[model samples]
Target chain A: MKTLSLRNLQKTYFDPYAGSQVTAVHDVSLDVEQGEFVSVVGPSGCGKTTILNMVAGFIPYSGGEILLDGAAVKGPGPDRGVVFQSFALFPWKTVLENVGFGPKMRGVPKADRDRIAREYLELAGLSHAADRYPNELSGGMQQRVGVVRALANNPAVLLMDEPFASVDAQTRMTLQEELTRIWQERKPTVIFITHDVAEAVFLANRVVVLSKGRVLDQIKVDLPRPRVWDHLMQDETFKRLSAQVLQMVRSA
Target chain B: MIASGQRTGSKTPGSGWVWRTMNSLAGAAVFVAPLLALVAIWAIVVPLFEVNPRIFPSVASVADAAADSIRDGSLIRHIGASLLRVGLGTLIGVVTAVPLGIAMGVSPAVSSFLTPLFRFFSVLAGIAWIPIATLWFGYGFGAIVFVIFNAVFFVVAYNTLLGVSTIPMTIRNAAASLGARRWALLTEVLLPGALPNIVTGVRTGLGFAWRGLIAAEMIATNVGLGYMLFVARDFYRTEVIVLGMIVIGLLWLLIDRLLLVPLERATIERWGLVRRT
Candidate 1:
């Protein structure tokens, strides 16, 4: 069964200043099976993030239905976790506290939540910086905290919106590797959104190319598992897949 | 950064309480030194110029009056009375203002409709209320306290409204998506997020309240610092008036430096995220 499926989803935003209705996502439909990684890649302003936000339940859709395991999504719940592009870690909280916030909200005991947070922080290689404030950490470290904070919720679906867009290239590569390793172990249904073709190809099993407000094509990435940067960067298949995604995005 | 480092430096492992005490004492000396120097200059200038006692009391005469007031316990009585009025008024103002402000702020239509009204009232706070207060409550503690209360309420409410309303929608959405309920959202997200602004409101409100208290005391009350100053004006007793002025100045400095300033600084530190360069 599909963990997440969108049927002809649409969103129309009323631009009050412009005095007109603008459609952000038009007839976009897609699905992700349980434990699958799907990356949605497109040019800027292609409504990819809008789709992610709707799935995360941060925004309302004008039409269509989003089903999770045959159940309709009512509103934002603990069932779907989201990693924001801006790394929206609460400034007042420490690394441990921010990571544990989800479990705490779910009424988990302090000791248990702390243990869960510590384990996830360990997975992100941030166990040593658990007590530090968000502002005191590097951008990469803060994003790592953001990822674990979402993961600690144990949501059935994980939505990532260009989670590494703000970091330096080297840090982005490192975070991608860290995320891939963690995702391999957990194997949650993930819908990752990005504009970078190489990044989308590297982390996803399937790449959905979006343009303007619709999906242009969905390409299956048959790259080998436990994908290594050195090997993947030089592999012919990786080059071909990335080139195809880049061409589609450019044309769209 | 350097100042915060010094403030937190005393928390070093194995640092004794005595060392921390000495460190704060040194910090206090920086403020005290200038006041002492001003007093020395006053003492020298007054006698050197042979200034008239009626116009400005000499340092010795002011000192004598201060000692006499203290010995007679009138100084403490007047100070205690004024402080009690401000305390009661401010307590009522803050308790009522915070919740009402948050409620109004939660709704956009109500908040926008009330913003101008709040701004108008806050601008007219303090002494403007004194006449009506005295007329409504009679000339006494009730009138004086009413004036202080009016002074604090409008400013605090307006600021709190602004604080709560200015919170980014993104943060609220983030909390909701993370499974926060209404109560949790208010207590954990809204309150903490608005605290820095609330503290700023308190500081500003208290400033207005302090000024209003003195003005109200002069007009309505019979036994406070402003009353003491006004009564001394009739007898040309410059020493008592000067003593009252000094006491008022010192009290405000003590309250702000010890209470409001620290509160503001702590909230700013707790909520103010310093952006990375």
Candidate 2:
């Protein structure tokens, strides 16, 4: 089943400085299946983030339609949870409260929401940090909270926009591995937008390469599941797929 | 594993509250040392210079004046009146300004219309209000409170507006995506997000209000510390004037250190991310 469908999606904005209209995303169409993990990969200015933002209902699409479970997305809603690159955890809230925010918003009782939060926090290996604030955590840990906070909402689809781009290289690998592990267990449909070719290949079932705001190609990852850096780093298929995506991205 | 409540911003995380409190007391003593040194200078200079009694009262004479005021209970009344005025005015100012500031924050049109007015008034907020306040309310409590209100209202409103607007777009988006309704966004996100700045505004505004309160009280009221100072001047009671001045300074210090600083430290500094950083 198509959980998220974008039909001829387009975004055009007036450039005040340039005194003309600029098309950021031009005539793009895609479908993400239920329980599918799709990574949208592109070079800078390819409008990959813009596409994710549109799907997340963060920004209005100037043209075409984005349907989630055959329903049009109007504005940001709990149905489409987003994980931001900045690790936008509520600094004022403890990690548990941050995770519980969604359920709380849904009018879940405090005890039940906290239980849900604790469950997600444990899933992220962050059970110990539940009482800590976002600013108190390292970048990697904060992003872990970011991931679960979205998941705890039980959204129809998760939108991640370069969520690990800001973290250190070592932490990024760990986060990517953790994300795949969580994805395998939960099977939450996700649209992961990234500029990183290897990351896109590592995380998604299918990698959609975007060029100049359009889908250039979609690469299916036939790599086996339970993806881990320890094995995947040395796997021949992983290297080949990554190289292909990297070449496309660098050229595009 | 750090205890959430015990996490003092920039302190060794999970430090015991008792330990922190004792250490803060030591820190306060360090802070007060310079003021004590200034008083020592005052003590020595007055006697050494052979200063006239009418010029600057000696420290000992100021102490005697303090004793006399304490005995008569006049000082307590004055202080109580001044405290009540400042407290009521600030309460009113904060209550009214916060919602308006939130309105300004959430809507661009409201902000555009109000921003210039707030900015303009904040600069001219304190003593400038005193003249008009007295004319509006007549010479007494109402006038002085009005002056204090004017001093706090604009600055806090402007700061709150700034605080809300400056919150990153991502955070707001995240909150919305988490199903935060408009009211929830205001209460949970915007209010807490803006608290550090709001507290800062209160701290700054109170400084202005304190000055304005004193000026207004001197001009318009027969009681309070400012009135006490103004009346003492007529009798050439330099000791009484000096005592009132010292009390004014100490009261402001106490308010800032005990009330405002701790407030900022507990909520915003440790929990809510401060607006600037």
Which candidate has the highest TM-score of all? 2
Q: Which stretches of candidate 2 lie above 4 Å from their native place? A: B1-18, B275-277
The CAPRI classification for model 2 reads as medium
True contacts kept of 2: 0.82
What does candidate 2's lDDT look like per residue over A1-252, in tens digits?
A: 889999999999999999999999999999999999999999899999999888888899999999999989899999999999999988889999999999999999999999999999999999988888888899999999999999999999999999999999999999999999999999999999998889999999999999998999999998998999999999999999999999988888
Model 1 pairs whose backbones collide: none
lDDT of 1 by residue, A17-51 (tens): 88999998999999899999999999999999989
TM-score of chain A of each: 0.98, 0.99
Best by DockQ: 2
Residues B110-222 of candidate 2: C-alpha lDDT, one tens digit per residue:
88888998999999998887888888899999999988988999999999998888878899999999999899999889998888789988989999999999998889999
Lowest summed lDDT across 10 adjacent residues in model 2 chain A is found at A128-137
State candidate 2's DockQ: 0.71
Tell me the deviation in Å of residue B67 in model 2: 0.9
